[model samples]
Target: MLREETAKLLMMIQGAYPNYKPDNKTVTINTWNLALSDISFDLAEKAFLAYLRADTKGFAPAPGQLIALVHELNTPQQLNELEAWSLVEKAIRNSIYNSQEEFSKLPPLVQKAVGSPNVLRLWAADGSYSEQVASSNFMRSYRNEAKKQEEYEKLPADMQQMIDQTNRNSYSAQIREKNRDAIQIMTTTENAEIEVKDEPTGISQQSDERLKKLIEDFRKI
Candidate 1:
């Protein structure tokens, strides 16, 4: 929201709660603008109205609270666990022959829970598959996926980018650690000439050079 819009919102809040007062009006406006600039004025106003209707405490909402309200207003309605399970159950009826089509028709969250068309087909063809167990599992998975998507959507753009970068870095570190372990195992089993030394230094110079070369090769990979 723009500075003017933010000021208008604060005015609305102040009007609602006469006792609420800010030490510095200009600072408050600037702070609110900084927090809500990504939101449009219309959406912010709607969020304010929604909060006003639901508020039990007569206190004015903080900037962070307004942001949360904005996100709540913006998020699309999601199917409940029972409703999602019903869709899956319907799809399973035709999954034996038209699993791909049925799977494609499901919502993204439902598709994530189902995993694949083949999985759906398996559930349909397998007589031993229990509807009670499958329904419970699919509902649980759907709820989990929905929650993850909601939380991710509520995060700020910068925070989302930071999380993505952290995940990538963590995955890269795992891969590197696995490769290092594999290289160590290969060195131990494949290179008999390179021997461990009991001297002050742990490994022989030849073994050290070979290990260094292996590390460099793994780095390239």
Candidate 2:
């Protein structure tokens, strides 16, 4: 059922953009459909819809893009374990420290959770960590700890010390919420500029007044 749907989707994409024919000599349609066989029908359809709606001029969506879209949209539980393992693999590659140095840098809690040096080296160096070891719990803990450390480093020195002394988890959440509010307000103000007055002198004065008001409002924030 999904195979046939995939075939139809391929045809739809080609039909929508006549100039964008995939290199069938390198990859046949059957092979592409086979690659996407594991994806559910609903996910495939949604991905196709999203592809069609994209504001691209002339390009067919690749098979890999469709697979990625399914992963991004549905994110099934079993696939999450695989993605978590991939994150561990990425961290290993991205680490500046050698195996021993990186192993030592793990938080005590993470070290305890990850087990011995042999296992740590396998995870960080060889990408041999099992899905069981890289469970959702470990993924969440590692990501949260990394995010906290990153945010802490970005703070002013005094603010960092104050947060450390207070040891308040809510402080991070408060900062994130404030950032979100500011972004929303800015977006609203930008979208509110619906009218463009075009008289020469009138436009110049209006622009000056609007700029001044914007600067004043920003400073108040």
Candidate 3:
């Protein structure tokens, strides 16, 4: 992935600086070898692509500039009040913890996002809080969905159709997996019942109960 990204970046650089003829390759392969070792392909490619789009003056950034951009991307900033609160709401709804004590033991990121545990507890118990939290959450979701839909609309007709088909195939695969699991569970239950019936009349009630419990647990999974 890094090599592929490196190749794309080099191509972009050559396009931007056509006059800068090189004695060697577009980029020294050895230089990329060292850079790729430290940063991920996604970070490098995203930063480079962002630079290409934002730097309208068309001055090519040096290779070190790309690495610096990766650092800028990694540096975390304080979230605004709404973003922090939305994250807290998401954690409260989705986290496995069932009690305040358990919630307190959640990851530090979750703790910090909540801003204050007391406020979270109060909001969680308030009916009005749900509407507010949901509105904030929905706003973010709507913006993301709108952006994706806008991008899709910009694509060529054929490309849009291809993406739609891929999404359909993914959904179909998930349905098939669920069906397979259901069928397996039913077949296992029937087979177990048959085995129990075939057992000698001396089979204990405890053994029958154990088999039923196992089947119930497996089916839940």
* Candidate closest to the true structure, highest lDDT: 1
Runs off by more than 4 Å, candidate 1:
23-27, 72-75, 156-221
Give every collision pair in model 1: 1-37
Model 1 agreement with the true structure over 157-193: per-residue lDDT tens digits: 8888998789767956666565545445434433343
Worst 10 residues of 2 by lDDT: 186-195
Candidate 3 C-alpha lDDT tens digits along 129-209: 665655565456545554555455434457778997897679555554554444434344444455677753444454456
| Candidate 2, 96-143: lDDT as tens digits | 224334445655435434443344444544555565655665677655
How badly does each model clash, as a count of residue pairs? 1, 0, 0
Best by TM-score: 1
Off by over 4 Å in 2: 22-27, 76-221
Cα lDDT listed for each candidate = 0.78, 0.56, 0.56
Model 3 spans > 4 angstroms off: 78-221
- Model 3 collision count: 0
